[model samples]
Target: MRCLWLLGGSYLAAVDSARLDLSQVAKDPTPLCHEDIVDETCELLSAGRNVFQRGPSGKARVLSFGELQGALHTTLDSLASYMDFIDLDPHRAGPFMVNCMELCSLTVASLPLTHRPPAPDVACYTSDAGVVCDIDVSDASFSNISFDTANADGTNKFEHSTAVKVTVEMGNDTVWSPDVAPVDPEDRDDMPENVGLDQLRISVANLFRIFPPFELEVTESKNLDDVSDPQIVEENGTDAREVEVAIEVSPTHSPTDIVGSGDELELDLSDHEQDDAAVGAGTGEVASKRKRRASTDGEDSPTKRSSGSVTEAAVTAAELRSLLGEHLREIKMAWGDIQDRVTAVEKVTQGHKKELKVVHGKTKVLDQQMTAVKAKGDATARKAEDLETKLEGLTSKIEELGIKNQATGDGSDPWGEYLARRKEGQPGRSEGGEERKSLSEEDQRSLILGGWLADTKRSIIESEAQQILDMPALANFVDTNRVVVFGPRKSFGILRFKIRDGETAAGVKARMWEVVNHVRQNKQTLSSTTGLGDEGRPMWASFLKTPEARKKSAMCSMTRRVAMRLAAGVKTKEGAYYNEDATTVAGYDVDWSTGTVWSGTHKLASASHRKDISRNDDYQALKLGWVDIRAVVAVTGCDWSEAHEAFQHEQ
Candidate 1:
């Protein structure tokens, strides 16, 4: 009665033939990804901005679907060179049909500052077959295996951010339950080592996140109890069960080979996860595209039909080809929609600008009017205050006279009579007999300050927002490191850094992969998926997978898709090689040269000294990967001002 463990997607079900339970697993969606065509909204904003920037002479470039297609081509071409694989599209269709995967090669190459994570962090295998990646791991995206750089005595391993939720069930020898933790195995001790023997059978279902860019949502959890349930059988098979073991994914990290408790490990077949036998041969004359079918004509082709008997209405190869084309066409339509939205956004932006001007003018007028009104109010308040004081004094005097009158007669003498009597009697009376004014009860205390009034203890307002960026901690790391920017694929920004001596340039390149791997795109977080109508309501951002829910694909290491580069030098010692940095910090010039990689919003977070690289105690390289860096670390001990001045004018 030994226990086994499983993670990510449906590996356990595919590999295990054992009867087991899977009751508590769940998938939660987070808005990690989305895709839209370059529409009017995107067009107007992206296109109009360039025109606005140029002011007069520059042509206002409208982004076409073709142009976008071209951009994708450009990006993919650059991306493929690093992966060293060819794109697979027999018909040379659109990228949508190709299922463009997140570029994890770049992320892996530059992260952890030394060792890179394997590719295939997140993926969607469809009805059609293919690997998410179409390239080879380059020096830009890969690192030489370091035997002694890691701190661990055992083998060093890293998992991509892709994950799945699992419940640790009770076994004769195990504790299996559900817990969601963002920490990667490389970042922490992943599964408890002493928990179980391989004899225990584990089971769970794979939940898909309906969103993209690596989000996951749990769909259903199956247990031994569900075999009798209709939904379980309807979902394909209730015959198999979950078995804990390893599953293999392809180069770009989509699940491929699955292993089990016994020898039953095999991958779950999706619409696209193909059988090895059906795959078109990897490298041959068959992959080449013919120019005859390639047409510059914009018209779409109609689907052809096949001839069979009862199912004679069944689809033919020609029809399948056409259907594929239509699918590609649908992808194109999505792209067009994106473009249209772009244009619409542009118009909205222009309208907003005009409205903004009008609003500004109104604001100015209001300010002036308010100033005058405030002055008038102050004058009125002062006048009223004076009047109030006068009234108070008069009231006090009147009260004194009333008191004297009351004392003078039982019926209370008239005011005129009291004064007459006062004059007669008081004229003879000394100063001691003269009446002094007393405050009226009405004026004893301000009504606003009474117990019945509202109570609001107002604190003095502070003048500014406190800085949340940890300045002291940032100073600590920057003082020792330099920065570089490189990628297995290109979109990395101008990286800013200060590097220490002895670190290799490749080491920096590998380390850069670590940072971009975890970039949280705003598309999901920008809006609440489960919309709230008004205030005081539950709010959630759109995502394919939530923090608790996971989308596991064995070793789904999309972390490699993000690329990074660090600044360092290459030096040769004897017959071996050495990578080193020129100085303690590489600043402005480093940023200038790589402005496209790190110059903008990206930050080098989660920096880890590759303890695995120091396994045998070699310190030349760090484990290059991303580990949840809580803050942005800068290159310290450099003349930043001077560096900026020198590179400010550079393009």
Candidate 2:
């Protein structure tokens, strides 16, 4: 009888020899016995656990040997429900199922087990096979199996629990005893009796009876009597008498030996022969027999033969030597021709080497020319930078004179004059006293929107002020006091400064333009001073725009405020923010809605009232400078439409 051991759905051992006597196995603690097998299996399981524990975060929860054995028992019991028993007889199902459970229980009992941690009571239900106990191992219930050190600690130790539902069924009925208590390893007196060796032998016997070991035999055979008949042919035609022969000459043998004496030359017919005379004499007899047979069969009778034969012809030693000499002469002539071809190839190779040297010399000259051109290019760049510096100095001087003349002549700021003319409904004039062309309302609005505000809070504005102060050409002429920084908030702020002493606002603005050009040219200096590295946003300094431009910007800010407020309301009601097209207030589009009072208050509720604005449509629109003023007026009301009231009163 053979023995097959299966564990965890895989074959553990397959012994083809005679089965061991259980009586002897029990008397002696052999590795083949059931008790030793269980111990070996436990050792393997412990090794597997150790492997599973290793990870980047360190070892997982370490399970004691007893706890691991208990988990194995529980896992096997659960797997029994899914086992296919179609190959077994249903009539013997009671004994077969009992043997399976007994075999599993006996193996687990043999282990030096310990009590597992108290597991939550599992709820089971009856299925077609039996009752199934289920413990939810979902991520929500059990922490996800993680190797991340941050998530792998004592708090997540429960994630390694081996609790599983066990299903035990009898013939056509579910058999589970609620009263049956689990084995207590700590209390030896309370523990169930250890299975005796005789009981273990009986369980093994029943297991083999129910599930016999598999065997396969293969054989091969052949028949020797199936032979094919040979065919006989009559030779009526005459055989060809011509014979072709070849002679091989050893390189060590002398040509004089070939011509000196015929007796010295020997003919070799068989390649395997050590002696040339023996091979020649044997081959000559065979040739004589074939010739005699052919001559006797000619015209007198048709000879019948089952197979063909080989015939050899013997040549005189003198003739063989002559043939060998002719072959040697041809070989010498061919060798001479090969030497001539090789010499011609060497000559062509020498000519190619000479050409390569000439090309290499020309390459060196081109490299030298490139080095000289690069040097000239560097000198030209230095001269261009010097000319730029001189031009900037001349421009600064010219602006200083213009500001002095303007201040003395008018005693009025150019920007203030321009605003005054607009207020009086008169045409404005430029700093040069030239009348400016009339602009359309759209063109005027475009200018207002495109220009920067005097008190705008933008990082670029602050960065520009830093760049201007850091410049070597302007640093001495314009002090920190002259570079007045202004804004509603800290950090990102505005800049306002006159370029020269006694400079009118127009002259200061003109000089600022010239300084901006210098700043652009020295970008590395500007970036370092502003703390705006190469990867940061672009920066430049300029004179402040008209008040109208500031008002337009404020209006745009108000529009964004209204839109943001509407988005907040939508988010609060629907639990999600929406874009401008989807936002609605009081059953109307948010962009066209009038202000609505809060439910508990009579005062109007607007976006400005809320401090936290989510990154919704309005927030993104503000970043891109796309807020609409009409939407602001519709939602905020005309009372707050004026730039001064909206910008000043609201934060």
Candidate 3:
């Protein structure tokens, strides 16, 4: 009947043989609001009581008990509605839903998350046999992926990899549960060289299961054997195998407790022993058999035999703790894997980098040669230009002299032939400006430059260029596994823990100190010399060192008016505090009770705010500069004596 209802619940179950991964479908894209809403509700509810208990001041003002209580109920109701809305079965529903939802919600709200957390997904699988199985999620999937790999001994095989999923009407709604991934033949990489064949055995055991009664029909009027034949070939010409899937119904989880998807199949002989004991109690069978068999095959109190199921409440706590422990282990394992993979990539990358470096060295040599060749060519051209210029001048003068003599009707000496011969010999002129020419000096310069270039090229070849005075030798090393976490220290004016390869204090101290100082100064300026909460004097003088002014134990209108006349301070009273001018002191204000003594105004809120910021005599808070711990550490090399000494004297 239950199976029939499961089939009749809805058509969604029978629609198709999708082998759906309901885990993907049930994924919560939003952070679980469970914890956040609960926390917020609790805090808001408690806020009024806390303020009422402590004499309302600071952020405690405006808190009301009635509103907080009402808000809490509202949050719980909203959460309850959500719990009811998820389609889960009645056999597996209750406080656990509330708890799980609350946790999910709280985690989402408190953290600045960019993506939604993973939710329970459901998937079902069917074998050649008609037997249907149902799997319910009990813990986080990422925490421990039960890989379907077997050691050679055939132990630790996580079967049930491929499972289809569908939403069945649990009791509340048609909510989907977590499912498994399809069997990927290649997801398991090749085993290490040393691993035995047994260790590398990859086999599917039982990744997931589907309930009986096909929702829709993949094998209608056809048996498992009939549908086993290959229908079509895949891209690789391998037969495309398909199977009918159905929505799961049986083996539901106790939503409040540990719900294991695996089996514990040990047989109990205690019942047989108990029956024998009963017979002995009636017929004295134990007395007759007390010799040898009774000692070896013993019965441990027949009354102690367990016949009922485990309680929901008992299992919930244990499983929750187990879940947390598993989460931490996963983090460590994932980190190890990441470190290992990165180390491998680094090696390959380094090899490529080395190749590039060698190529770069070759390029540098070639560049030097090119530079030298260019210089030689430039010098040779310059030399030719100079020689041509000199030759042209000499030739022009000779031509003029010859023309002048001819005009005077004197001897035609035929000097042009001699001039041409002299020009050629001079090595500057080239065919009387018919073409270009080179100067001898320029040619000499080219040869000198070329020689220098050659020498520069030689320097790069025979020896490496100069490095640092005594540079450390470069070497290759890899740490591809675990990461070491360092201790916490003051970094950038904030208390920070150093993770392995995490941010360094040295890098951020300067900027962090600047912000801290700025905020501290502003705090001092706002609290001082005013007839605010100081009442003319500070309550804490041991920690603060502020300037002087008269203060009053009891505030009066005259004191408030006179304080305005007497000192400088900010008038930052909020709307709620308007009835009572409850603005606090910042600078040194006079304390009539102490008769005008000095004070120190420290304001480390995490410690004690009043103790840090109050003056005993004067009602003023004093501001002071601070030396950054990280910078001090860097400069001083080791001892924190300087910072500790300052902190000690700060009072």
Candidate 4:
């Protein structure tokens, strides 16, 4: 049987007979010579002198078709068993794909036939149609062939019908069974003789359960004897009747020039065994034991040999046994030495393991120490942060004291000056030493406000005041020095000053107009607003245009807008509205009748306006009432002191 393995895909079925290119075989006629085929097959099949003779020395011999079939079947079974050891069930693994193409190639290449083309010589993939396998061995033919189809000793019909059929055609004559359906060969005529047999065919069905069973009958017989082996039909375990299927010659042999058997080959072992027996004369028992060992292993002993070749093989087997025993002794001695070394190594390893345990203990102790240090470092870091915060606070206090000390002279005081004037019976003094009469608090406030007009550049007392009063005369009030001032209204008393050198009612009216204009302009732009009730005027229009307030030039409306901005906060129980900075009172009131804008009622200033100014260093100073002109004068007095020193040096 010449089995063509179907791997990867159904290539054997996919490729048609027309697509096969057998031209190379036709052109060459003999791809491998008879001698080359014999040499190649020697490694796999049993070899005999007749099977491997040189050219023209003797008749050429070939392996019978039954032997080839048995070799291929046995090889396949061995490979399947090997795959099982590796847990690869070939049946379940599906068709041999490209992944196993290498394994398939090796298996095919290892077959004992030179005329057989290796798998790599043919294309395995679909992209290329490769050379077809055409094994022809009609030239190296064996004359002596036997057919065995005896049914097994069973009454089972399946076993009775399961048989292997072999046929040979010799020059236009079928020497085996003719074209016929299923029949017992026992009932047929004897196999034909006196025919020059050249081509031999063997087919097996149901040899194994995996392959589908099939059979073939004798078809046409031709005079030409150059038929190559056909692809093996798959075995599909069934009892179907046989038919006339195509057949071919094997690749391992040539035409019918000889007849031989490859079973009687044996190795000669007598010389080595005799030498061992002479060397160990007293070891007759050992020799007998070896002979018994060979027998137990299913090998024929010297006494059991039936032929000269078998006797020679038995002697060679005895020599091998003696050599193997010597090797075993040496191996035992080497293994004992290895065990001693292993024991010493184990002792060293145990000592190392104990030292490692000690080192691990030390490592754990170091880790604990590191953790302790880390905890201490964390506590120290927290302490350092606390110290940093305290230091920052102290630094801020020092800086505040420095700025205050730099601004205010040590001995110069505005309150002290007022006290000195009162003690001297001089309520107000002129530069010419005239004893001025004491003025009302309202008049004093007007004087202070008037002084602020000249000092507006040096102070921010009215910085939040909006330019609401747009009267031209009010714009010139600063130049005229005709404003009044009132502020720093403590719970016990109020402060007032006057700078009465211009028309007080006109300055007041101009300021009122400015306030009304600011409210009218910024009714929507300001953050919030209140106290300006509906005076029958549009929100965008000047409140002074209302019929009732027009008489006062909208002075009442302007006053209300000012009061609303100043008192923009939640009112306290004392009727005071505190600003967002809870310590700062919202605002104070203005007594326009006396031209006095008083603010001391809530310790605040009744500035004409107070916009929602952003908190910045300069504006914050003004908001905190730290921009008093007295403080400005005291800080700036050192400039005059330096000038006096310069003048003295000039003198």
- Largest lDDT belongs to which candidate? 2
Superior by lDDT: candidate 1 or candidate 4: 4
Q: For each candidate, what is the lDDT? A: 0.26, 0.32, 0.28, 0.30
Encode model 1's per-residue lDDT on 373-472: one tens digit a residue: 9999989976765665466556645754564455556666565665786778753222465343432222221011001111211110000000111234
User: Which candidate achieves the best TM-score against the true structure?
Assistant: 2
The regions of model 3 sitting more than 4 angstroms off are 1-379, 382-651
- Looking at model 3, residue 508 earns an lDDT score of 38
- List candidate 4 stretches off by more than 4 Å: 1-323, 350-354, 361-365, 384-651
Candidate 2 per-residue lDDT over residues 297-352, each given as its tens digit: 23211112212211222233233324433433333233334434654786788899
Order the candidates by TM-score, highest first — what do you get?
Answer: 2, 3, 1, 4
TM-score, one value per model? 0.18, 0.20, 0.19, 0.17
- Taking the tens digit of each residue's C-alpha lDDT, what string does model 4 give over 522-636? 5422111223453222223221122222223233223333334333434557865443322222333444322222344321221233423452222112211221222111222
Off by over 4 Å in 2: 1-329, 332-339, 357-372, 375-379, 382-390, 402-651
Higher-ranked by TM-score: 3 or 4: 3
Question: How far out, in Å, is residue 607 in model 1?
Answer: 85
Error at 157, model 4, angstroms = 56
In model 1, the Cα lDDT at residue 343 comes to 63
* TM-score of decoy 2: 0.20
